[model samples]
Target: MVLRLNIDQIEPATRDWICKVQIVEIGRPRESLDKKCTFQNLILEDEQECQIRAVMYTDEIEQYVSTLKLFNTYLISTAKVKVSLTSYGKPIHRFYWILDKETVIEEIKPSDEVEKPLSPPNKLTITSFDRIPHLMVDSTAEIDVLAVVLHCGPQKTAGRSHHKCREITLCDNQQNQFLFTLWEDFGEIEGHEIYSKMATQRDLLVILGRSIGISTYQGLSLQTRYNSTVRVNPNYPQAVALLNWAKQNKTMLLSSPSDTTSTSSSITPMIVTPSGQQLLSIADISSAASMGVFCVNAEMAILDEFQDFCVLECSGCKQKKRTKDRKDFHCPKCNRKTSLVPRCSFQIDLIDNTATTTASISAELGEKLLSMTAEDIFDITCTKRQSLSLNPVHEMLSTKVFDIQLRKSSWTSSNTTTTTLSILSYMEKQHPPQSTTDRTSKKIKPLEISEVEVMPTTAAAAPSNAVGKLQPPTPTKKV
Candidate 1:
């Protein structure tokens, strides 16, 4: 004969008792060594709510600890009962349960009983955000949910880091957002790529195996297990539904307030100009420089020169040990050897129209022209000349009118003191030959001299213009 008993009808008087009970709830064990207390709470419901606290010794806890997991239904027997006092001195009943080494745990198979009254969909469940619970389901279970993608990093290769995992910001229609991490190695869907694709397409759908709650900076978040399956496609029917839902609930997912503050607080690159006027192009420099442009300056001198390359002195100290030469300059400031060294320095090298001379200009005045491109250089020389009154020396350099600057010195009669200045303004003026005319006009063939042939003649000529020669007016007027 089979006997049925209600959970509430079970009496503590049944000594050395053996009773069968369905596990309505299962929880993780809590232990307190100072209080000499260790227990796990289980709830049973057989016509009424019955809560039982199962106590265990340290030895028994170690024996069956691995076999216990929350939410698994079990039939526990050989449990002892006792009365315990609450913090308020109220008496509470507790049970001391143990599973001997020889006792075997029999897995209870779920019944195929027909459903009775279904749970109301409107019932609200309270859960803690600090510790999210994991939901376990069989491999054959099917589920549907909505999720979001939060962060994505670069993809990696076999020998490199992998990029299959993506952190997601998920939410249900309940106005709640949770973080979900998806791993792609398993059959799980590609969440990051899907979210990116759907951002343009406007919707996504996902189906997965299990949901586990984990702690994150943003509180408790849900994650997908390896067995979870996700499907995201523009063609999915659920995606269409989600799009329609989003359209109706436009204000639900508002942008986080933190994002606006971050974007507004960003730093932009600093722009500095002497005239405080914005320059549009290289041609704009004529107007800009004429108004005194802003530029950084450094003191430098030519240390070495090669065929077409020259190195300038760099401002840095060098360490020195034993050296064969004892007369080298040493910088006591840096405690290193000090000497002019070859380094790249920005300076304008003037090239005349005749390709006859090139002179290096110092400071900001020099760097302005050197920084222009070949095309812009040609444009500046051909046009925009009047606006700048660009020193006559620079004009000749830009036009390639001649190839050399004259170096000259003068001695004062009273003290016989000598002063020297180098000027780049003198050179021959040779225009290209005019096109032949049909009438009696003579076509003069302009002489063309190569740079190599002009070097010796240029060197032999004595410095005539101690001060630079006056520059002629430009072909056009300033705008």
Candidate 2:
């Protein structure tokens, strides 16, 4: 029998080495842009608990698709070991494996005759909730999370594709709260469960497996990817500790009402504005200047002339066209001719007795304020296409008192400082959120609010509308 080696000891020169490892993760089979090639990735771990990513091309993937199952131990040999070019490989080891047709794989079957092999390593990397803010700088590093579920927003449809999404507020031991989103099926299944639980249970413990951090303008947030898993109140020491912490701070966690957010692009991403949303005085907002997000009770102090009230955005990527005309007939960014969607683009002055700032409004809340969809409004403005017109929004909001959520960002240059505030959502005092929640749950209708304008999580000289991610998304997989 050949001696087995740990993942750390295997190198490019170790041609004769064999590894008795368990498959911890199995990435979906991905095809190239041209659909000319296909590949699947696997994360393998040995007895020492060291992990490394192993990839299989179309040929090898088909050969072992059934032979290699998750949690099954196998004897692997003759796979090439190469240095990883990315830091996102969940690494203490720098090398990744590539198994070709020549590589040997043998599933170690269970037997009564011999002693049982070591159990498969769970391969969980539980990241502290506080550390998530710092970890946002590395988008590719997927982290497991143990968080207390404070609130669950009603699952709603969003985006041009009308994807189903749900947002939940998660609290860590440090008392720091952040939003986590469940997309598509995860939202339908787990989101429905949590929303149902909130009716009875005050706090719920959730264990997330392999969640990606989205450092949006809303600060550090989390979302489920295609490979991510959601486990509710699993039996574990870390989760038990988190449960104890949640029980201690139930009131504080649920004090401030929020709608929550989705995507990595939005910050102050709280979309849930309580129906009875209480407005805070401008004086009250100024005192909590250190906070990244603020929901103030303010009125339309001023409304700017609606110059570009609506901009045409690429339906595929949801980015505005950069052409000089700003309304190019077709999207240049997409590989093919993609459709354009009309989104609300305007600004209004929000004011209280103590302070004031210009808050930009786009899509989401802008629709509610105007009482019209962006598309319908866009068509009306396009006939004769007036450049600047009397802003109609002022008249509607001038007399109305609304609860507005704003994200504050500042920049300093040439010894001069400028601050920008953008409105995230608005709430009518008479209209309660629970009523809206019940309607959407039965209808499952989606809302489209693609464009997000806010600064990074950290304070910097960057403009208010500019959003920064740890790394630009990879053009190919978008994984």
Candidate 3:
């Protein structure tokens, strides 16, 4: 039933392929043509290194995926061969296999006849957040980044296709912070472990591979590409160095014993109460020793006019919707006629009398602040021909002092450092501050590297000794 063929012998007309292959990498399943498609890149050995791209479109995609476990050899048969298309995301191989419902795959038994596995096409280099801006704009350069987990957002279904993603905060040694997004398969499964680790105050190290994505909404965010893996608290030197740095520099400023700890992570504001965490005035925030999350009591000075506040989002990809006809919205990405979802984007200026800064808040949080969804707000502002003045928002927040938690992140470009502050949380009622004696410093325990998940069967699996020498880790066991 298996017609074993060499990689060079296969042609586009080949209908069946029975070959021994070691699964190199598995791409997260992506939705296409209203159906989910899974892709896996495999390695085959000959006089020279060769690769094969395998795709599954059948309903048994999950079953097939489980069979082609990473690093495991398989005897795949009846797979239809085809010339790889440049539009199929980005492929590492020139030829691809289309496995429909009729294809057969079986685990290759361990024997001397089986050839040695070939290394995957990965150079595993750990990069810094500061260097991200200099990288080639549209190149498929696989780079790795290591950072500390700051905050993990609730899993939200996104895009016009309604795919799920969990947004998280990651910070580096330079105190630079960036947003990292975990897509659908990861959001549903591995993301819970990351959330738990943060809640428990566990020192978690995150390493992302081949993530090069830029967005206007979240500046300099990292996205997981095909075959990429997220490793938490990996047993590597960089992880240890980061842990030591975090433990030593958890607080941004070196404060007096009586002063409140200036934390880079989340800080519950202690305002209007005899409390634990000391509150910093808006002017005092910029002068603090380090860059991180800060808490302050500030009133809304001015709300920007609502001229382009609300935009139409495509129901399929969640991208901005455009149209020639006002009644019908079209998605440029999905190329489909889709329903429009209204969302808000606000740039509100806040002032505590001591200082002023502009904070950019996305539509979801804007909805909470205004107590109205973007759709509802749009109707009142545009549908009714109401003035673009943000009188309603101003009236709600003006003169009302709020205990606000702000995250201060900085990045350097062109030999200049630029700092930006974004609101994390705010409360109308002040909460008591925590006492320094009540706080417990977390200890970094030496991780058993063996407990880390099995590495991919590639050079990326090499031991990490120095910076940029990172290997993708297996999923952490749920705590």
Candidate 4:
């Protein structure tokens, strides 16, 4: 036979020893000293919402913590209650619970008003992603849904701080993505392999509980709440279907509309020399400007040992000085030093990309380029040692061949004989642009440029010869 006792009516046992009792309320626990010790605050609604300091000792914690499911009724018989004072002038009850060897957990049940399942709730319906509801859900509400795994990995040191967190990105067909972050020790999971496996194969659906929430990283994530469950299987039919859909609509889903705009804006075409016959690549000008160099493509041939610094007339003051004073290399035209010396040292010439008719890269952009090698800039396989010795002509030559062969040139009039001589003089002055012998001596490493095999723009447009239909595995019980 089952016995039920009113929490408020229980009188203090004469022995003043721990007694067996049912726990009516398991209010949210309070964390103190950085969540080291959790203070379970409970209240006997029959008596009052009076604050109670229920301390779970470390050893006792191991037992009850696992059984402390949210919103589930539990029979915690072995517990000690004591009187404690609060910040206010009133006495409250404090329960110190410990599980002994003899303690046994009774049957766990959903809270009052248990709903009879029509079936096993096989058809799990997932509505739009919503915020985790404020109210607690009982174990009966457990359901499964097909969710795309966006990101998953073990916790790492966040920023410069010592705190660790695991970040996961998840998305669904609804065109919504959520970032899930598991904090502290909970962040360390099996490994990154789970994430890696899911990344290559989209349309993965894992069983999750309502305890999960949309994390700060804007991803759907789960916590170690008692009811949470997860599993992955390649054979699951639901998984197979979702995978097929994702593969079919991969291009439509992954392609961003703004990509076209950015691509077009970055490809700037301009003529750098007066001959105007040889069209200079806009990227070359951007690269030179970023390196603090001021010269046309024709003049670039003459540079040998690239200097670390350059002098430019300050666009603001029109005074020639080392371009280092202002953040954006501006000259102090309005200052008193402008007229006293007839030219202010503050006046710095802006390194403008005359080809694109734009200002030169700031000091920040130069620092970025310094960290990158010529190989990184030109997407070549030259060694680092070779990259350091690379001259402007070599940089131009490497890019010019591709431009000439692959793209159409916009020619201009004026093929002056002096232009050829000027170009030759510049090339001679530079470290005799890297010879074929030097390139051969450096041992060119095989380039690893992955060929981008573009897929059809739409599922319907896909070639009939396409290999297989994308399909996810069926949803099965999580192991």
Q: Against the unseen true structure, what C-alpha lDDT does each candidate score?
A: 0.31, 0.59, 0.52, 0.31
Tens digit of lDDT per residue, candidate 3, span 290-389?
5544567666533335334566655566555443123655557668776775665555555665656565444444555665667666676657756554
lDDT of 1 by residue, 279-300 (tens): 1321122122121111211112
Best-to-worst order by lDDT is: 2, 3, 1, 4
Winner by TM-score between candidate 4 and candidate 2: 2
Task: Name model 1 segments beyond 4 Å from true.
Answer: 1-4, 15-19, 24-26, 33-51, 69-71, 88-479
* Candidate 1, poorest ten consecutive residues by summed lDDT: 454-463
Q: TM-score for candidate 2, please give it.
A: 0.51
Candidate 3 runs further than 4 Å off: 1-21, 27-33, 36-52, 59-66, 74-79, 83-89, 99-128, 135-148, 156-164, 171-176, 183-186, 209-212, 224-479
Q: Is candidate 1 or candidate 2 better by lDDT?
A: 2
lDDT of 2: 0.59
Best of the two (3, 4) by lDDT: 3
Off by over 4 Å in 2: 1-3, 87-93, 112-115, 127-133, 138-342, 348-356, 365-479
lDDT of 4 by residue, 1-479 (tens): 23334344333452222222323334334444456865443322221222222445445556667665433333444345444433222223333233344444443354435521111112223433332211112212222345555346555644212356565544455534433444553354422445656667544434232224322111112333222223343334555665666666666644522112112222111111112123444335333312111223321211222222223333333344433333353224433332111111000011112322112211212212233421232222112212233454346444221111001111112421100000100111233323221121221121111233323211110011211121111233322
* TM-score top scorer: 2
| Residue pairs with backbone overlap in model 1 | 209-228, 352-400, 352-401, 353-399, 353-400, 353-401, 354-400, 356-403, 357-403
Candidate 4, which ten residues in sequence have the lowest lDDT sum? 417-426
